[model samples]
Target chain A: MDFQPTEERRMLADMIGKFIQNDYPMKARLTAGTSALGYCPEAYSKMAQLGLIGALFDEEVGGFGGSGFDIATVFTELGKGLVVEPLNDTAMTSGYILAHTDQLELVEQIILGQKRVALGLIENGADYDWSAPETLAHQTGSGWQLSGMKTCMKFAHGADALIVSAQTQSAPGISLFLIEAAAAGLSEHSFQTVDGGNACEITLHNTPAQLLGAEGAAYPLIDAAAARATLAVCAEALGVMERIKDMTIDYMRTRKQFGSVLGKFQALQHRVAQMLLEIEQAQSAVINAANDLQSPTDERNRAISAAKYSIGRIGCAVAEEAIQLHGGIGMTWEYDLGHFAKRLVMIDHEWGDQDFHLIRFSES
Target chain B: MDLNFTEADQAFRQEVIEFLNAELPADISRRVHADLHVSKEDTEFWHAVLHKRGWLTFNWPKSFGGVGWSPVQQFIFEEECAAAGAPRILPFGLKMLAPVLMAFGSKEQQEHWLPRMCDGTDWWCQGYSEPGSGSDLASLKTTAVKQGDHYVINGQKTWTTLGQHANMIFCLVRTNSECKPQAGISFILVDLATPGIEMRPIRTLDGGQEVNEVFFTDVRVPASNLVGEENKGWTYAKYLLAHERNGIANVGISGQKLARLKRLSLSQKRRGKPLADDPLFAARLARLEIELRNLETTNLRVLDEFSKGAGPGPESSMLKIIGSELEQNFDDLTRRALGRQAQAHMPEVFEPGYNGPQVAPQDMANQSAAYFNKRKVSIYGGSNEIQKNIITKMILGL
Candidate 1:
């Protein structure tokens, strides 16, 4: 079995990687993260023009690629630059959900950067329990009236619309609704997350929305979208962990403390070697998960959960050890390690923390 | 065999509490307790307060203007100050150099520098760790050549903690390269105002200018600045390092940080309950508490040895390794408790009256930075690796 990505995927990865490296410096990323719009619209448009967003979807949905490997490749570059954009929420999860419905045109707009959408599957206090949504939708004469709160809605502040998961009175299970940003009785409380990205706590007071997919049949779509998102973040974490490992090695080679470079210390050498082994193991997990994306329900879920769990544990270990090995220099805001470490550690909090995934792995 | 403090020791502890309550500046203590930044001015102000109360030199001999408190009394005072959030007494002047001078300095050196150190007239910084030096401090390349009545010094020193505020530095400079590396060293004190002496800040990972790099380009100092016989600096440096390692354990500060960590865990939620209520989190916290409890006992045993007229031996290295690791662990758990909220990097929020947007809660202001900065504890003061080597040599006789 081949482990390397296809030539087309490699070219796509190179293009996106170069774009991020050339345009998105740490200062620019920080500014974009802190901006009112949450992320750089120009950068998003540039990436869209480069066909980066379209690579996450099938050509039938006005895209060139739609596979777990495609999602992983694009996001790994995003993770390298610490890009604070809404690509995952928009082009990956929301796009997947929309593609499964009759709104194929909306998916096309998403891929072209003409529309930005964020998914609202996580409810307040319902940590990753997307199967039984607490947010309820009441049937109105014309559209639908959505009334509930959604938490951890990343980039929801800047989205053109939100795809929310809710239990409807007309359905026995979870359904999907598309709520416009300017919908009546909708409110968003925005804040900056720890990783220099934006998130919102959304409240809907009988907000006007329209049904997207079939009633009581959106759980499988939501589940699949979440799996793709999980795979993307796992790959992104690999990118971040690799950068941290490289930075640590460079530091050890250059930073002398005892008449010789720190790398000469056998104890520290072992720790760095441990970091390498952990990163390799995490890479293997991500690769397995990406390949297993099209597997049956139990297998796919188990593989994704295993990767997420490994990344959650291994990413933090690598990040923490890198900082420890770099000593005082690793923790500064002016330096790049602190930011990468934060991202690596915080990735676990999203897509379910390590403990959550451990249970998911055991049960699935 | 006794674990409880004597009534007299308890009385001394109460006296320390009363003094902290009366003399400690409320604003300084408030900032320290909240883990906010303590400015240089604030630190000097606290030193002045302690000096006025005749407590600044409490660890020194009574002949050197110290109170000559018991070892247990000293421990009580340190713990109380840490609990009250008092600024740490800068060790470069008061702790590291003073012990060396008291042991090896002539009467003139002691009379001049000791009083200045106590009155805050001369801020001191250690220049023992050069860029190429650190754990191998004896291999330092900074040199001082004898020139008539003056010695010309030329070399660079890095990791000079708080050298920006220091008017004086105690450095170990190479005197005679013809001999062994450890034997050719000499400990000499230099004034920051000396011509050709320069100090540049080395900003730490926490975005702090707490340490610096000092350069000496043919800086001239009086030959009398030398503390002991020429080429005998290595012995004095080793003595100073032993003294430094004893305090590096920082049992009191770690205890204070542990308290803060528990307080934070109580407020942070996980699985819709307080993180402290989570069984896994609670178990880790319990393990840490046990470790700290054992460390305190070990620290006291060492102090007890000191009381019985034995200097800190290689066992002190054990304390250093465990103490530093314990502190790093506490920092790790504290950051994890905040979850993603700890990732916010607002350095300005650490400044004492920063009215800007408080991104995270006041308690969570610098958890990530603290986690990053605490890494130095293991790397500096004879890195934990070096301490292990010392233990292997002296304790295990390996």
Candidate 2:
């Protein structure tokens, strides 16, 4: 299959890449390290205003480009910027659901970056078993009551709403619900992730909710959505990996040991080469998955699992090797390698860890 | 965006499959499929068949008597051959030397060598690696000094694979000693029948004489035998090495081996259970399969670029690195599948008709030898270490 993006997509990439280079520098990235919202809110709006949120959706849903490569292109640029905002939570998951739920009003707000949304899918000890969600949703007339705890509800700290997946005690399967951040009986304790973003342990006690899709049949949607999230994170991780590699290579070229650059040594060169092969392998998997997005469910799952497995393993490798190759300076906070490395490792752990994806790959 | 082949491509694939099934001798196919020893006559016979069909030098351009297939067509032909268990087209003559000749050889040299190379009259061997020059190949010490009308060549070349079957050799000789290491070299074609030359078999770790050592003591060669200018062998040598590297990423061969490994593992038992059923083994098998797919895609990408005449810059080295490593992995797994049977390295069992050793089945007995031979895949082609250096220089600019 052709790997080259179309002219339109390339222009989109160029714009986004230039934006990251011109606006989102190390200072901008580091400023969000301790911010109250854990990111630059103005920058978030600027990203949405630049059509990133819309670029990931369709014209029917207030945007233009929504292909797999389109999403990959956007995330790759975001990854290079080390953009602290959670696009996986806000756009890929919540925005996806809102677009599919026939909620054009909410989709318009999201595309305008006037509001934010997060998906509450993770539980503390669920171990990535998304199909068997523990959050309960009970029907009350036309509305529903959601009562459960979602751990690490990314971007929910200051979001307009949360797209929560819950099991129905009466219907016997999981369903998707749109719950407002101000919904009654809902509480959260927000905390910072190691990678410089905010997430919360959200507890909902019969929180009023609006159904987003078919009741008791949201498992497929949840699976597909989570798979998309995994794909997005992988693309982002690849972007971060390239940046780290460039920084490490620069250090190797300039840094001297025994009156020669460290890069002249065969050992470090081999390590870098190994890192590149892993990155290529991981990239091939993501591209494969991206193309398979419109294929059958089995095909999609197989590709997604393979991509996640490769990215998780390789992302961790580039992360650890980028630091070790940089020597003592690699570990210090002032160096951006540590930050990007942190993002890489955290990305690996977020969707599915290496071991999890390896076994899942076998099963898939 | 489109992966499907055109109607013509599909027809070509079918034609290739049908021809292979009809013309490939079963005995040679059986030997290749099982990694069993095949006689030189068998290889020559298959070579002659392809030569007659004008498909022997598949890598060359149509102007040089090649089939002129597209990169995709070349890939399809190779994959089908590997799948059909056809013996590999020996690289020394067709894949390696022919390209160099087509590029830089004089008109007389091309007319004399290319035809013979295609018709199986000239079995060729490469004389690049010396006793002290492998990865540091530029420092090769093989010397050739010009006399009145001839050049006297003297030095030793090691690891000349299948040299015993070769009647011709392409060598890198140091024609100028005062210049830099790479600048002083020259490429020369030598006839095996020349005086002052001797060949001796070097038994490899697998107890096979597939390689040899050739020593020269003032071997006289006509000065006109030089392919290009004096002190320019390094350029042609590098060109040939790039071609060799492209073949090292043997995706089709490895894919066939993977299929065989899975089949054998399923039939073979480990601790009273089928090895394929073991989770640990299965996971590794699946992982290997996944990496193979990745490499296949990567190869396609490289070929796509090459089809556009980019000719696989630094990426060939990456393929060489991974392709060799992947082969070793497959060999290691094959040995593991053999379990204790791999310990029996009876050389007689490797003899074509020897059925004496019954402790291990013939196919199982083949694993250790194949594994040992595959160990050199990474070491021989400039070594994976050198490949990594190439990658760093090309991709990382370091």
Candidate 3:
């Protein structure tokens, strides 16, 4: 029944929260988001120096605090500031895959922010299915040769390596392969994401790849990593929703029309109350999913799907409602709430959207 | 009692379609339909094409160089233009300012400006919303002090759509601070090239610089540019707002977007089947279609009243609210149908001669940005909340 975090996790949250408050103003975040690398490499390196990235990994792999609550605590703060770093791809998802494959050295490097690794699982038509990737890997004498197109590889433009899932010619199931970013036969078209992050459409033409784990057995691990990533975004969405709600209330309290502040009106007050209620519900969902991350597969999947679905649905409502309440200012680029709203809606577009998870929840 | 278009109206629609097919540039139509950027040249070219055909000023009386089409004919033309992906005739001059000029401006002003508007000599942008005043526009603080033959305008106006491309701006400025906020305001036209007037682009959430903030540092304008009596701007502003509210519904654009959305959904796959076939997605599209249908009917009803010589009343507020919400709904569904593919933000794809790779769906490179951009529909032009408030007071008699 205890809902509070441990003292260590609370300290972790406080440190990250303070860092965001001090170094990550909206203007700075905007600059970083549109920077050459699509994020502040210096700030990321600083976060690593602060031991923030290491907190997402287990001690066996690199550092302490690999629990779901650890991921939630770190990402919720990042989401509050709308930080555009590739932590979810480089550390959370690819780090999990590397750690599970006993690649402790690379995992340690990622934990220290020395290497950035992006996960390439989604294909053009695959939607969310990681079990039967269209990307193909052929067995070679020295290593493996991969050929496929991976779309929407988040932060792929800046990654040192990519942990890509592909179907093997010699096997019937999906497998994980680590490919260098500069490998031959690899081409990428990088573009900024709608949420101010960067992504690339990676086309592999017999690109060299090193298999990490057993062939034809990458599905379960891929599914697990996806669940973890999904939970991270859901937690992040909870953070985004909270910020939107707060900004909206602040707007209502100050913006005057008809000789009175908008908040004084009962109609607006009720909608703001509804936004608060939805945000609280989203918070509970994140907590529940975080707690269930280490549980059995079905239970974990169910909780994650429910949470993600709630976030995907409720996050949009809150984002749209916040903009409507604030009017033109909410739609402006200079205003901070608009960015939060953009991140919130685009979060649903990422990991998996509401429709994707609704189907998953029903099946789970 | 018959709901279908009359035979003559159908023939008129066919004529409009043929005219668009012949005159509308293929590139412009393709770009418009794809939601890509149409250059100022393209817009002006199309505006000139329509003006030459005497169809650009369809809303005006024939005596004022208008084609003077009936309401049904206007509806048919607009629908056909939307379906054919014609560049939207910029509403600032042709719709908003022209009506006010014809209604309140002196014969000299109308004679000078109306022809320039039709001839594409001047690109006009509205300067109504200020940084301090959006929903409550009367609270604007931009001042217009009369100085002999010219008025020295000094203040800022934000959310001026497409002002960067404009040579002229119609603004609401404070003429007298002694009176009530609404009473002291005056609507005045100013040449944007006037000294001390600086227009800085205000980037929207979609990373587009379509709107601007115009700062007036003692910019001077001719006092004769005032549309009507001094300090009577509120009356003219309200009149123009009500007059233009019916078009804010944008029923034709929604229909066009819904069609594009359906095609996108069908092209996108989910588990070996078209995303459109998925029951959940199907239900959403179906619901959007139903709502659009209801809105179309309501809009036609409004136009029906207009044909009988009735001005757009407060019921236009209902159309604004529902229409903007429906268009936003189409955006939501379009993005949803793309899933993570919509995350691709290659805005340059909309640029002419952009041969870059499309990481997402073809012609949908900006779906996410468009979704983010369309949030302005509910926020601007007297925000939907303000429309609701108007409905509450004026229509519901609350």
Candidate 4:
């Protein structure tokens, strides 16, 4: 039950942190977020070249054979950069799901940066039901056919393939299918997320799909993928928290109000101190959840729920407080503080909102 | 960095758990779970039980009649006790003053007082906070003028927790006026029954008489009662304060309260479902649990450092800050879980044989009382604001 990151993991985190700080600053994210694809494919290719996309899988599956902590390290750095990329959705979630299947060729393509995939888990009006899919899949004479709409398909425009969840007619159970973007009867309507990332409402009308695993066995796979996605979001939230703390401290030091720096005021100081404490708590939860990712079933589920619940609750509070403490400038789109807050709010509600995660955690 | 308990530690944990299950009286445990103030008889009964088990002075050295458990073992013992609803040991003697006495007192002082403290024969209260000198404790104005062979003490001490129940008090008194405020102070041990001393209970927001205001009008005390040098009381006071601040962390107590909150939340219904099923409340509870976990780990780290023979320094300030906030937050959540029930009861219900006001339910009669009582956590053992200042100066060098 060691919660501390390994020394190598720490080094990896530091390296990623430096890379994000030097290469993908807020301006870069702002520029990329406004792009047609919502993220820089060139930057993502660079990340793939650095072997960060396949951090949590085996070398045989075209990965670095790193543990969940390694992936968390990368995601946390990406979060600090407020990177408007689908690294979390594609690399962590879809990549993890692909690695577990027998599709080595597809996994290798994703690992080699030749192809990208985005997870389409949240269907329209789904409302936090990860297992109760609104989309339906039917086994056809040719292969499988998917028909429904998945809203908030993250980075959908950039992804060459989509790993989606649908209920099959035979078992009426949620299953996952990998569908190519150019398949017949596939359409995407792209829009901007609150954080300036590209999200799409993907409509599938008898879209040709390949079953990733055994029929109706993909629920657990999707669950694991969702857990991975949650931890990645938590890591990113922590990154934003760290930035807020640093920025708040910097503002306190320089921005004087009433003949003294705001940091000198006990009220503001206590508020910042509280923000640090919440971030630390969330950090512990994320590390614990990441460590439990491959552990026994019950413990893994408990840790994941606990992590998501803790992060969703504290992350949103910290983000909101960060904006409030920054005063009027924080509300403007021109300010980076609002950008981080927006990302935090979006990520907080992505896998499950605080309320949704809390119910799952308590029931578990 | 590992949180896993060793097999031996687990066995020790089981032993403690078993003892608590077998030995703790059901009524006492119920009172503890209910957050009701335990009777003096119940407190003494548990104290005797622990004393017989040779665990009364859990933090004392073996040579001083203690279990002499390792730091982790002590942590486990405290945690298990709190979790099992055991009454908290009065710490003015055992946890706070004993360490200072061990470090600075004469051998005779240790021999005369340590055994009594271990046997729970002497209940001690602290006389540090005065009307004007709480956060700035060294500025206390209580004076002890040296008379023939004794010091005549005069001045008042307010917010003396449990002082009305104490037979003795350890105090910080001004002995020399020329030196700095801290340098002019001397640590004095005074008998509460002294002729010129008077104690008046101060009713707190908590609706309990846990603290008192003690007035001294030329209370005479033998010069021998002085623990260390006459004008060096500030150093001893600081030492005592470090211990107080560390105990003020109260992670074990907070952890127990968190568990109780969970049970209450599970049983209580909100919006046609258990409060535990309410996503908002559940998220809040989970966040508290995570914070408590981090606090527990940080506390263990501090304990590990202490076991290496290093006393708590300014880092204890950090513990105080985090611990008090967490405790307050837990109480707030509990109150939130209690909902309107938290405000339904009057303070009089906590008194003996009240039965005057008809409350919502038997369980909720004390909810407001508990909430009011917990409000003092941030104010006592030095305010958390003071703790932050200490951290800022010590760690941040601001």
Candidate 5:
């Protein structure tokens, strides 16, 4: 069977690559990294103008009806720029939830860039376990009352709304609810993540929330969202890996010690080769996962878990090796190598760590 | 892109699986599964069985006594053989030399060796590396001086894998001294039993005499045994090496090893639970499995390119590098799973018939040995470092 990207997908990838090169340079990312939101709002608005945020949904949902390949293309570009935005969490995850639900109005708002949605699924003590949420929601007078703490909610301060997963009091399963950012009885404390983006601890005290979809039906949706988010992060990690590799290689070429370029040493060369190999492996997994998104249930779950496990492990390894290879410069924040490394480390732990996904994969 | 096999390909895969299930001996499969060294007789037996089915050269052209299966079918066959634990058919003849003969050998050369190679009449060994030549293979000093009708071959080839069991050796030797190093070389076929030829076994750390040091003290060989024109042997040798490196990728073998590792890990208890339950170990295993999957797909892509009439190129170098690393990684994981059992240093463990001391199962005992043995995979077949250079120059144009 063919594994090469389609001509259309290739064209999309090229376009995104060009966009990152021209619009979002490393300096721009560095500047944005110093901001409160850790990303350029103006640049993000431009991305929305290009229809990237809603790339994977149908036309009726105000999206391009683009395939997962399209989303991958956009994310790869975002990664190349080391763009510190909540697109991965907000657009990919929250947007996925909105697209799948019957709430066309909210989906339109997210698609048109009028409203931002951040995902708040991970609860206190729920160590990256997406399915087993500790947040609880009870039937209220009109709809639902949510009462739980969702920790490490990306971009909560920037979002207009939040998609929260909570256990239903009346049922034995988890349900997803959408609540306004300034809803009464909802309090948030935002802090900087390792990558310098905002992740919030949202405390919901009987917060008025509306069901995003049928109760207990959000598990599959959440799983799908998590998979998409993981793949998106992998695309970003691949970008960071490529950048780090290039920087390391360039440094070796110039940083000669013993009468020759450090790159000439076989030991260093093999290390770089190993890094490249891991990146390629991660790339293959991400692409395979993107393709598998269209497959049937069983295959999709297996492929996604396989992708997550591969990317998480390889991504972290590459980042660590990249830092090691760069010597002292890699550790300095001024050098920008630490930026990608920090982002990679954060992404590696997010959605699911390598071990978390590995267990899921083996069990599957 | 889709990974689904076509209906016809699926049927062909089923046929090959059935054949392997029916014809491959259970004891041989068991030995392979356990990573126990299979005897020469077992290899020859399976080769003969495949030869009888006209599938000995599974990837060769029908013109050369091969089954002439499509690339996908060949992949399926290999996947089946590996999954069924069929002993790996030694590739010196079928995979390495046969292709060289097909490409650069004279019609007479093809007529002489092709049939014999298929029928298990001649077991072949490589004579490329010398003590000095490893990754700098073109620096080889083995020489064959041409006289009137024959070449007087001298010098030595080290690390000749399975040379002790070989009846024939395809060698690279210096034929001209005045020219450049690579230019002066030639590819020649030699009878290992010829006069003045000697093979001394080199016992590896695994305590197995699988490799040999072959010496030629003025061994005479017919000049007609040269595969191609004199002084062009380097080209032919290079051609043969591309195939050798590709075969060394051994995706099917890696897949088989990974499956076996999974089973072994599941059987071993760690902290009152299977080793597979250990998240870190499971994660590493999963990561390796995923990498192996990617390698498998890339290999299939390479095979598809080959079926379209392309020869092995720099992409093959990528395969060799990744494949060898993945193999070594799998072995490392298997060793790690063995843990304390892996530290057992009884040299007698790998002997032909020596059962001594209370030990882990034979399989677990062999894990460390396998790991140590595989350390050379990245070093041999042109070290992964050299492969990166090839990729840098040929592919990335660095």
Candidate 6:
């Protein structure tokens, strides 16, 4: 019956917020995202030390704090920092799938910061049908052989292995296979994402791969895993959005125009208020989706999609209003405003964009 | 934040649904659910039913003869009522003025007015808007000059909704001509039966007499009728308007409309298929439903906070803007879904028991009326534009 965050969660929130405030500034984040390595190795190590990686899973999965609130709290703080790392894909998307499999060794390595994983699921022009994998896998004497082009392998250049999904000859649906990053038949073309994060185009030719879970049953797991990833993505976007609102409002208070602060204009003030209204609602949707993760499949699915859609929709609003409120300077690359705005747009495209989720939500 | 209702709250919700299902009249329910032009009798009948059940004054304090439900209970009551097609109890007397009287009226005023309002003796309409001072309400020039033991009033109030059926009117009058536009206003209550007062019905865009223009020519009222101090009317008027906007988030009503829209899109055909099967139309409907869901949650969050004893703020204006726009958007979609048939209906098409040629389906005959009448949703109750200004002042401190 309580609408307020618990004392424990509030403490966690304040600690994480301070960690980001004290350690990760916008400039450092920008440098890390646009770096040659595509991330700050030192900062990634710090996050592992802070138990940020371990916070995404439960005790049975070799970690603690796996409640929906934990995920929401962590991602929200990270969003405020605008930290560009591969934790979303590696530790969340691939991490969930790995936890469900009998890969105790790999899961422990991930929490201990000894190994990094990347999800190689999406292919060129694949629009969110997780089971519609075009990559093909065939049975071999030692292990299965995978051959396909996987687009947008998040943090692929940095990860030690890839959780690649491909269609198996014997399976009716797509199956997940774990392939080493340096497997003989693998090649990668790495680049930074639009929001200044790392991803790669991975091409595999008869790549040696090990099945993570039971063959032919990966689609449901993939669907559920994708739901979890989308939820994390939304929570992260909520963090980014609150920061944008804060910065925009602070700018309004100090930035003067025509003998008064820009916030003095009723028109601009109203627009900001409207932005707050939307983001508040978006936040509620995220919380609801987070809570509904363990509910029945149908209810959970609808809520996950609703959360994704609301965050995406509200992300654009926060972006537009923040930029407009900041006026011309908001769009500049050197300023953090433009970065937050761009990340909001990118968040919409991940998992399922607003349009995609809307159709899914309506049809379901 | 927990969205789970306690078991007791769940029980309360079920009780509300049961009450509404058993008591609401079927014919009036049909009109409300379809957004048809509801007669004054329909509203009165529903009002009396709620009153007899000791629920009509749920928003009032218990000591004042109200049900005195918590904000969550109030929300549940409203949600059930709107969902079950119950006519909205007019707020001019119960919701708006009653709160003002409770807060500022003298003991005699409370004893005299509160019981009558409970028993449905007085039907009230607001006298805030004029021809030139709709949004800029402080510029209102409805003069009420002080005289011997009374106040002499002379001015015109425009867009007085339901004034034709009202027995009393609450007005914001210009009491001091030589002071600030805002500071000089006074609030007065005048009996509609007084001489030199004229109420002319104004047929709105929907071709219904939903609003009126009330003119007062030297109408005198006892000084005791003033709610608070003279020249403090603007403050009271603002308070009442805030109350008006408070419940403007009509999420339950919009939920019903969205359901009806879904039903229509499923049964109605376009391009040789069900309208719901059309990709673009389906997308629009889905977006509307998502917005409605989000609005509902946000509303609950606000009501939850209010139940914790938080005062009403101008954030209500934000809710008003969202809720009104959704209703308007739904109306537009309903009409469009009816296709060419929606445009052919007039006022007579919705008259109860009119068995004319089927224009739009019998259930959806009010699409055109709903669309045209709902255009005023954003314009009245101090307009969405005024709401923005209030939000800016209250939140942004601009």
Candidates' DockQ values? 0.35, 0.01, 0.68, 0.01, 0.01, 0.01
Runs of candidate 1 with Cα error greater than 4 angstroms are A20-43, A80-86, A98-106, A118-223, A247-266, A296-298, A326-339, B23-27, B245-247, B347-362
lDDT of 4 by residue, B323-382 (tens): 877987886577556542333333344455665433223444465446445556666776
Candidate 4 lDDT by residue in tens digits, A1-364: 5657778778777877777877787778888986778888888888777777767566777787546677678888877788776777776678788888877888888877778887887653224456667788988899999999876677888688999998887875678899988999898866544356676767899999998888777888888777777778887888887887788788778765444766888898899999989889998898889888888777887888888788877876786567555543344454577677656655654777666666677787
TM-score of each: 0.88, 0.53, 0.97, 0.53, 0.54, 0.54
Error of 4 at A333 (Å): 49
User: Reference contacts recovered by each candidate, as fractions?
Assistant: 0.30, 0.00, 0.69, 0.01, 0.01, 0.00
| Tens-place lDDT digits, model 3, residues A240-333 | 8878888888889898877789999998899999989888989988999999999999999999989998998899999999988988778788
Model 4 - which docking category? incorrect
- Name the candidate that leads on lDDT: 3
Model 4 B-chain TM: 0.94
* Residues B1-398 of candidate 2: C-alpha lDDT, one tens digit per residue: 77677788899999899999899987678778767656789889988898777777777888877788888788888888888888888888888888888889899999999888877789999898786665568878999999988999999997788899999999999999898888999999999999998998775534456777899999999988899899999989878777653456899889988998888777765435677876766887998999999998888788888888786477888899888789778876775555433433344454668655233344555665566456567767676767888888989998
* Residue-level lDDT tens digits of model 5 in B69-181: 88778777878888898988888888888998899899999998998987778999999888656556787888999888999999999788888889999999998889788
How does residue B295 of candidate 5 score in lDDT? Answer: 89
* Residue ranges of candidate 3 with Cα displaced over 4 Å: B147-149
Q: For model 6, how does the per-residue alpha-carbon lDDT over B1-398 read when each residue is reduced to its tens digit?
A: 67887787789999998898889878878878778767888888888999899999888888888777777778778878888999898988899888899888889998998888877799898898886566567888889988999899999998888899899999989999899898999877899999989999775534456678899999999999988888888788778767653457998788888988888887876435677986867988999999999998888887776777777777688889899889877876775566434433334545767765443566665565566456667767766767887888998999
Query: For candidate 1, lDDT tens digit of each residue in B122-157?
Result: 999988877666667778999999999999999999
Q: Which candidate ranks first by TM-score, i.e. highest? A: 3
Candidate 2 has which clashing residue pairs, if any?
none
* Model 5 lDDT per residue over A183-236, tens place: 989987654443656666678998999988888778888887777787777777
**Model 6 stretches with alpha carbons more than 4 Å out:** A1-364, B346-352
Cα lDDT computed for each candidate against the true fold: 0.83, 0.78, 0.86, 0.77, 0.76, 0.79
Q: What overall lDDT, based on C-alpha atoms, would model 6 receive against the true structure?
A: 0.79
Compared with the true structure, model 5 gives a TM-score of 0.54
Rank order (by lDDT, best first):
3, 1, 6, 2, 4, 5
